[model samples]
Target: MNTISVQEADFDVGAEIEALSAGRCDVGAVASFVGLVRADTLAGGGDEVSAMTLEHYPGMTEKSLEAIVAEADGRWRLLGTRVIHRFGRLVPGERIVFVGVASSHRGDAFAACEFIMDYLKTRAPFWKKEDTPAGGRWVDAREADDSAAARWAK
Candidate 1:
């Protein structure tokens, strides 16, 4: 089964991975990534960020994420995938996102997990606003993120 969620609450990394790989004998490898909020380097030209609030159009966001997962599944020999992204006000050092992939081999799991992350960075319909000492400012898309996602294009 493939699980996709866009929630406001933080998630447990281990439990999510276990949910993805549980009772699956064919799954020989599980690859995962967890993204966290950092105060040191935030968007909007801030050296210190107090908190970041993520916003998304609920239904549209989930559909976009599902499409990303589907594309990766089609390209790789994956057993299952789970993607969970958090929205709302989040402080530094808080868990932001999780991407996990289960496959029969190390290569497929790693590639698919990375591919999913790369796509999610660019394709997901989530906007961020950072609360810095200077005040609140909306975060813009970074060119570096675009460059990373572009490599996967056909």
Candidate 2:
């Protein structure tokens, strides 16, 4: 089973992973990633990020996420995958995103999880704004993220 969700409520990683591979005896490995809002960063003058708000086009965002997972599935032998992203106001240390992959081997599960996250970082149509002492500033796309996504190019 594949699960994709864009929500404002926080999620339980363990529950999602369990749901993804539930009753699937063939699954041997499950890889998961949980992204959290960082309070401190070197992005702008090493300011402390107090809070963040994320926005996205509802239908468009889910489609982009599904496409990313589809790409990963095509590249790896995945038994199941789950992606959950949160929007709206969030404070530092709050969970932001979750990616889970289940496969018969660790290699495929690991690679597919990373691939989905890398692509989501660059390809997903989500906009973020961080609140700092200086004020709220829109987050810019990181070239490093682009570079990471580019590695999967054929």
Candidate 3:
């Protein structure tokens, strides 16, 4: 099972992970990643981020996330995966995204979880605008994110 969601409301990680592998004895390991709005200056947080607004095209965002998860399923031996991304005005330290993967082994779970998040950071069609002391500014694609996603190229 693979679940992909894009919304403004926050999610419960424990619930999401549990649902991914619920009643599955074959799942030996479950790895998850939660992305948060950081205070990093490069992310437009300047000294402090009063708020961050994330936006995405209605239907396109969900489809893009689905494709990223499908790619991870093809690359790794995964039992299930969950991807939840939030869009709206968020404060620093607020959860922004979550990627959870379940598998028979820790390696597959970890790798698939990371691969899904890497692709999500680079390929997802979501845009961000941060509100800082310097005012609002749109975030740019970081080379590091691109490089991370590139390493898994088939």
Per-prediction TM-score: 0.94, 0.95, 0.93
The per-residue C-alpha lDDT of model 3 at residue 54 equals: 97
Q: Per-residue alpha-carbon lDDT of model 1 for 78-107, expressed as tens digits? A: 999999999999999999999999999999
**Tens-digit lDDT track for model 3 on 1-154?**
9888888899998999898778879999999999999765654333576789998888989998988888888888999998899999999889999999999999999999988888888888999998878789888889999999999988
Residue 93's C-alpha lDDT in candidate 1?
A: 95
Instruction: Give model 2 RMSD, 1 decimal.
Output: 1.5
**Which residue pairs collide, candidate 3?**
none
Per-residue lDDT tens digits for candidate 2, residues 1-154, read 7889999999988899898778879999999999999887764566888999999988989999999988888999999999999999999989999999999999999999999999999988899999988899899899999999999899
Q: Give the TM-score of candidate 1.
A: 0.94
Q: How far is candidate 3 from the true structure (C-alpha RMSD, Å)?
A: 2.0
Answer with 1 or 3, whichever has the higher TM-score. 1
